[model samples]
Target chain A: MSAQPAAVPHLEIDGVSKRFGETEVLRDVSITVPRGTFLALLGPSGCGKSTLLKIIAGLETQTGGHVRLDGEALDGMPAYRRDIGVVFQSYALFPHMSVKENVRFGLDMRRLDKAESAARVDEALELVKLGGYGSRMPSELSGGQQQRVAIARSLAIRPRLLLLDEPLSNLDAVLRKSVRVDIRELHDRVGTTTVMVTHDQEEAMSMADQVAVMAEGRVLQMGTPEAIYERPATRFVGGFVGSPPASLMKLSRRFEGGWRFGEIEWQMEPALARRLDAIRRIEVTIGLRPERMRLVEAGTEGALAAELRSSEYLGGERLLHAAVGQERIAALVGGHLSGLPKPGEPVHLLPDADAVMLFDAENGERLDP
Target chain B: MRSSTPLLFLLPAVALSAVVFLAPFAWLIYASFKTQGAGSLLMADGLTVKNYARLVADSYFAAAFVRTIGLSALTTLLTLVVGLPVARLIATGSGRAKGLLLALMLVPLVCGALLPSLGMIHLLGPLGVVNGTLKLLGLTTSSIKFLGTTGGVVLGLVQAFLPLMVLPLVNTLSRLPRDVEHAASSLGASPLRVWRRVILPLAMPGIVAGAVLVFSAAFTAFVTPQVLGQGKIATFGTVAYQQAALVLDWPFASTLAVVVLVAIGLALILSAQFDRLLRRRRLAA
Candidate 1:
C-alpha cells in the first residue's frame, strides 16, 4: 500500500506525477505493491486512477516519477520492451482477428517460436474458459466473451505485471458479478502483480487484496479492504465505502457534558471529551454507519428523536428515512421485524458509541480515535 | 412488422437508376458492339466483336488500359501512404483540432479539380516552380517536361482525390476505439507490429473506401490527364475522348468507355475479396 521497501518488491512507483498542459492529473504519488498481490486503485472518474494504471502499463508517460519492476528501472523502455499486460475497459479486442489470432499477437510480437505460441494461446484461452472460441471473430462474441478474449490475449505473453482498467464497467450487473470472479480466479492462477483501476468500491473490496482510494490526484489511503471498511483514514473514504452510506451529524459547539446536534445531545465520556477539547468553536462531524444506527420506539430515553419521512422496500430488507431537525438520516430494518416506521410517525434512533466515526467538519480529515 | 413490400419504397430509386444510369449505360454497351458502316457512320446490324478485338489487338489501347490501372493503383497507394498517418494524427487530435484538420483536408474537395490540376502544372511543369528552382540550383538546364508524363498526371489526380481518401479514413479511424492499440502496445507489440497486426487490419474498410475513391477518381479523370498528359500519356479516358472527338469513331469510343467502366466495376467488386485475402494472409503469418 505505502512504500513497503521490501526485499525487492514487485512494482515500485516512486512519486509519480502527471501534468497535461496546465492541469495536473496526478500529483506526486508513490506506492510499493508486493509480489503476487492484487491491488485496486479505487476512485471516481477524473480522480486519475486510470492514468496511474496507464503509467504502470507504459501506455502513458509520467511527467515526473520513477517506476521499477522488481527493482529494474522502467525508463527509456518503450511499451514493447516492457513485459506488461493491460485489459482495457472497452475490451479492445481486434475485430478483424479471430480470438486465436488476437491471443497469439503478443507471442508474434515477442517473435516466439510458432509451436510455442500456439500452445500458449491454447493454454491462455482455456485459462479464461474460452477454449473453443479460438476461431471466432471478436464481433461474433458476446461482451463477456470479448472481455475474456482480451484477458487471454494479454496473459498469453506471460507478462511481468498485469493492469486492468475498469475491466468490468461495460458488463451488466449480472454479468459483472460473474466476470469479477473470473478476474480474481485468473489472478490467483497467474499470481502476477496485478493493478486494477475501478470506480466501484464493492468491486475493489471484493476483488483486491489491497485497495488504494484516490481523489484529487492523491492517494487518500491504502490498506486491506477490511481495514479500509472498518477504519477509513478520511471522511471521504468513510462515506464512499458503504452503500446507503454513513449519516453525518453536524455539531457546531460541544456542550459541557455531551456532544450536541442543534437541540439533540448525546452524553460524552470524560476521557473522550478531553481528547476532543483541542478543537474550539469550529463544527465537528460525526459519521455513523446507517446499519449501526437502530430505530427504537418513540420517546425512548438516550435516543435521538426523528420524524419518519419515507420507507422503501429493498427485497431483502426495508429502509426507513427519517428527518432529525433539518438533516435526513436512514436506517435499514430487517424483514419480519415487529415495528416499522411509517411516514409522519415519530421514531427514535440510537447510535453505538464505538461505531461513531469522527472527522474535521471542513477538511474531511479523520480525527484520531 | 406490419409494413408493406419494401420494394415499393425502393421503386423511386430503381426508376431513377433506370432512367439516369441503366439506359445510357445499356446504349453505350449496345453501341460498342456495332462496326463502322461508311466513313464516319456506326451501323447497328454489324453486331461484330471488331471493336473489342481492336482493344485487344492494338498495343496502343493495351498500353492505355495498363496505364489507367497502373496510375489509378499508384495514386490510391500513394494517397493511403501519405494519408493514413495524417488521418491517424487527425483522429487522435482534440475536438477543435480535429475540426481544423478536417477543414484543411477538405480544401481540395471544395476548390474542385481545375485549381489543383493547374497548381500541379505550375509546380511541376517544364518551366514551373520545381524545375525553375532546380535550374537555379544548377541541378539541370532544360525543362523537365513533367507536363506530359504519367507521374505528373498521377500527382495531379492525387491532389484532386486526396480529400476523398482522408474523409472516410478520418471518419473510420476516429470512430475506432484507441484501446486496442493500447492493449497491443502493452502486450509488448512494437509500434509497427501494432499498426500491422491491429490497426491496419482493423482499418481495412477505411483503406478500401479510400483506395476505391482515389482509384475511381484517377481512372475516370479527364481534365487532369487532358491538361497534364497534354496528348502524350494516353489512358482509357484520354483515348476514348480522342476516338469520340478527333476520329469521330463512335463505336470504338463506346468500346473504350465500356471497357474502362467494366474494369472499374470489377475493381470495386474484387476489392472485398482482396480485403478477405489480406486478412487470411495476416492470420497465416
Candidate 2:
C-alpha cells in the first residue's frame, strides 16, 4: 500500500497465505529482506516457516497475496522461472550425479557457455571448500560434504534470493557449528540476499542478521536478532528464541514497593519500570532469562531465597537448578562460584532486573513502554 | 564362515526350487536337442544341434523370431510411454486417489493373461467396441481393423504387460524424494528438463526393472496375441503351439521354444548392459 521506496527490497513477501484443503498452513505473512542480508525464519515444527520460504522460492504457491522481487510482482511465474535457489533439508543431491555435475546442472539449465559454466562450477565447489570433490558422487561424500555440495549447487546459480530450509539440521552438533561458520563465511564472500528457516534458536541467533519468529501459521515478530531476543514482540517470540529461552512465570503478585517474583517481593529496575507503559498492571507473567539470574548463599543481602534442586556442568559454566516457591529457575555460573551448590541446599537467586521482561498474563503480549 | 544353521534353514525353499523350476527347465533344454519324434515329452535318440540349425535356417522361424522381438519391444516401449505418467500421477496423488489408481492398475495383474485376451477380443474384434462404435457413428470401413492384426496383438500385449511396467516404476518413483524435484525446478530447470535430467536418471533402476519385466512378459506372452490376433499373426508362442499340437514335431517345437527363450534371455542381458552403461556414464558411485 505504501509508495514504492527509493531502493526496492531484494525480496518482499507481502500478505502471503497458503491453505492445504481445509488446513491453513500459512496465514497472511509479510517480510521484506534488504539486499545482502541473511534473514532466518525461526520457529518450532508445524510453525509454517518452511512453507513461507517455499512460497518465496515459488516452490509452493500461495493461496493469497504475492511475492515481489525488486518491486516487480512475480504473480504468475513458475518456480522454474523464479530465478531463486533452494537447499532442501535432505540435501537432495542427484545421486546419479557427481558433485560437479550437481553444481553444473543449474548452470546448464541456465544455458551458460560451457567454459563459463565449468569455471563457475569449480568456483562454487571451491567456495564451499569442496574444490576437489567435483567428480565425487553424493553418496561417496560425508553428510557435511554432501551439504556443502547442496549449498554449492544452489549458490552456483547466483539466484536473486537463496532459500535454505533447515540448512544445518542434518549435521551433528559439532559439524553444525563448523558448517554454520562455513555458511556465514560463504554469505560474506558472496554478499547474496539469503533466507534460512530453522528450529534451532541458537542457529537463528548466531547466523541471521534479522530473525522472524513464527508459530501456528502466523509470523509472531520480525526484527534484528538482538531486538528479537531483547525486545520480543510476543510471548511466543520471547519464549521461542533463546538458549535456555526466557522463562515465563505464571505466579507473580505486586507488593507495596514492586512485584513479587516467586518467593520474594523484589524491587524493579528503574530501566524496566520506565520500559513498561502499563506499569500499574498486576497479575502479569515475567520472563527471566536463565543466564541473567545469579546464585548466592542463602539469606544473602539483596537476594531472594531459593532451594537448590540440581546442577549440571556445561563445560565452561555450570547450569545450576533451583526452585523459588513453586517455579523452577536455572542460573548459569562458573566453577569458581563457590565450588557449585549440591541438591537440596538452600540458596538465593538475584535476577538482573534489566534482563527481566514483562508481559500480559492473558494474551501473552509484551506490556512494554 | 558365518553359519551353516542359516543354510540349513533354506533347505525347503532350495528343494522346492530344484524340483519345481530347475527340473522342468533342465528337461526343456534337453528336449530341444533331441531327434524329431512323435508322442513323446522325453528326449529320444542322441542329443544333436541339428534342430537348432534348422530353426536358424528356416525363414518361417526367422520371421517369427523377428516379429516376436520387434512386437515385444514395441509393447515394452508403449508400456513405458503410457505407464510412466500414470505411475507419477499415482505416486503424487492424494491418499484415496493413489489407492484407487493402484487398485485400477492391479486389475490387469489379477485378471491373468487369459481374461485380458478375452476382454481385448470383445473390445477390439471386428464387431467389438471399436468397430461397433464406428458403426454407431457410421464410420465403419472394410479397410480398418483393431483386432486380428500385429498392431492389435501389440495393443493387447501392452495392456497385459502394463501393470508389470507400472508396479516397479511406482515403487521406485514413489520412493524418490520430492525435494530433489523441487530443487531442480528452483534451480531454473523447466519441468520437462527436470524430468529428463533429474527424475528420469534417478528412476533408471525402475525403468530397467520395468522394461525387463515387460519385455520378458511380452516375449513369452501366449494368450493375448493368440486370442486377439485371431490366427492372423503367428508369434513364436503360437507357432510353437501349432508345431507341437498340430504337426506333432516335438523336437522342432522344442527347438523353436529354445530359440525364443535364448532371444528373450539375450534381450534381458542387453537391457541390463544398457542400464549398466548408463550408470557408468552418468553415475557409478
Best by TM-score: 2
Q: Kindly list the per-residue Cα lDDT of model 2 for residues A1-369, writing each as its tens digit.
A: 233465788688899899999999999999888888899999999999998888888877899987999888987799999888899999999888888989999999989999999999999998888988888888889999998899999999988878899999889999999889889888988988889999999999899999989999998999898999898887788888787766687635555545576556654445555555355676777788888888766655446567789888887888778877777777787756666658998877777867877788899998865
lDDT of 1 at A100: 93
Residue by residue across A1-369, what tens digits does model 1's lDDT show? 234466888889999999999999999999888988999999989999999988888878999989999899996688888989888999998777789988998898888999999999999999999999888888778999999998898888988888899999999999999889889988988887799999999999999999999998999999999999888988989988877788887865654545677766654545545556665435778787877777776555556778899988888777888887777887877756766757998888876656777888888888865
- Number of backbone-clashing residue pairs for each candidate, in the order shown: 0, 1
Q: Model 2 over residues B1-285: C-alpha lDDT tens digits? A: 478989988999999999999998787788888876446655567989988888888898889888988988899899999999999998888789899999999998987889988988888877788777887888756525877889999999998889999999998999999999999999988989999998898888899999999988888777887888888898888889888888887777878877777877887799889988987876554
lDDT of 1 by residue, B1-285 (tens): 437678688999999999998999998999999976786465657588899998999999998889898998999999999899889989889979888988989888888777888888889977789999999999999878788888888888877888888878888888888888888888887898888877887788888988988898889888789888888989878889999898888989999989878888988888878978876754543
| DockQ of predicted model 2 | 0.70
List residue ranges in candidate 2 displaced over 4 A: A1-7, A254-278, A297-302, B1-16, B37-44, B134-143, B282-285
- The total number of steric clashes, by the backbone 3 Å criterion, in model 1 comes to 0
